[model samples]
Target: MGIQVWFIVLGVGAMTLIVWDGKRRRLKQRALSAAGISHNAHAAGSAPIPDLPFEAMLPPEADTPTATLPVNIECISGGSRIGSATHILGKVIADEPVLIKGRLEGTLIAPNHPVSVTASGHVASYIEGSCVDIDGYMVGTLKANTKATLLSRARLQGVVEAPRLECKAGAWLQIDVAQAASRQSVAMVS
Candidate 1:
């Protein structure tokens, strides 16, 4: 009888711990959501959050075409990021990798590093990088020195110039393929 009682107690304790941990996680998730930090895994398949005023997150030099912004201050993991709530209308030049989760309407130049656009990102401008990966919506011209990849959820219109181009199964592309010949000559030479 004592052994049965101990087992019951242990089961109850485990259940209590599980409940408490679930509540704790809920509270933490609520706190993070209120603070504009979202967990990507938890927010998957949900409707996009409304745009917030994220202009203050931009570097002061973002509007200046000639200015080079430092990577360390704006980077999230050695790469620069444009948050989901931000929208910029000018040029962006980065020496390091760039991840876009917002809206950009001008030029993005990262000639030596990769540039990625997430599923929530919208870019209607020119993108130049070493490698470009798009999982969102983009219209205009994209130039990548090495490769350009359009993911399953990506939608692209206009032109793409890359030595290697990959379009996933579900991606939508309406491009002008005639002007995408810049790297073909170089590829043949090498």
Candidate 2:
């Protein structure tokens, strides 16, 4: 009887410690979030994470083909962005708008939506979208079937072939722009 009682007391103590630890972790997470800090350094990436914002919006789950990070593969309809200071490599196919705020070294295909390279974005590959908005730096081919806009802080060094092109003042564009052929081949197949 005495041994059983000691066992029960030890179990209770362990449970109590677990509960307290859980609470402490929650508080720490809250404090970190409030201070503009993120603790989501779980793994690296090589695929496009759907619906993830570029500013520390870490979804509890993500889907990418890299297999290095635990992410989902379910296609999404909304926009997604690579977070700042993050690095992504591999092909990305999305029907929604995508913003790259970090570094991406692969293809970004948004045939129906736009692909925006924010002021902190660095893309070193091909891009295909309805509209391409460049505010940072991009190297490689940029093909926007509809239009491509270069903001004031844009730095582009590659081939750009879009039906329409617009550039803001102070934008650096060393790429040659040519009129793109009609994109009727990949039109909405409805």
Candidate 3:
């Protein structure tokens, strides 16, 4: 065929491929919708969440002085948050701090930062960070370079490695604790 004819044929083929790809994406989206799965690009980190006032993210004030909040608002002010309604099953590597109030079933690596699991959070993954604070349930290994603090409502079942480990009075723990400078791991069942 002539050069001009070859160019025309190539142009037609490109258009056909573009159209086919669009249809394929639409079909995949439809299938996910039918399965009741969210296909939002924000969940995949392709887009940011819509901007909202900071007050909208804050928890309501307690009626009495004895009631404590589930999470520390100050710690989460500029950090990443996994809301209570979210369920994520992938790896997360954050340069900033991470606050989890939902469920996570993979790895979370936040070097030189903090990681917190709130009262309603549930995590089954490996966590590595500068510090870790837990008030929820976790069933995996946690490596904190500085400290690991378990609140009154925390429940952990795995291994914890930190330079300093603090457990509250009512925390439920069934795990092995390894101090950073120690050569032995302590088994604690409570």
Worst 10 residues of 1 by lDDT: 181-190
TM-score: which is higher, 1 or 3? 3
Ranking by TM-score: 3, 1, 2
Root-mean-square deviation per candidate:
15.7, 17.4, 16.8
TM-score of each: 0.55, 0.54, 0.60
| lDDT for each residue of candidate 1 in 117-144, tens digit (9 for 90 to 100) | 8878887647889989987887667778
Evaluate all candidate structures by whole-model CA lDDT and list the values in order: 0.67, 0.65, 0.71
lDDT of 2 by residue, 141-179 (tens): 788989998776666765677878887755665555555
Q: Which has the greatest TM-score?
A: 3
| Model 1 CA deviation exceeding 4 Å by range | 1-76, 178-190
Q: What would the per-residue lDDT of candidate 3 be over residues 16-58, giving only the tens digit for each residue?
A: 9999999997985676566444333122211222232212323
Cα lDDT, model 3, residue 59: 34
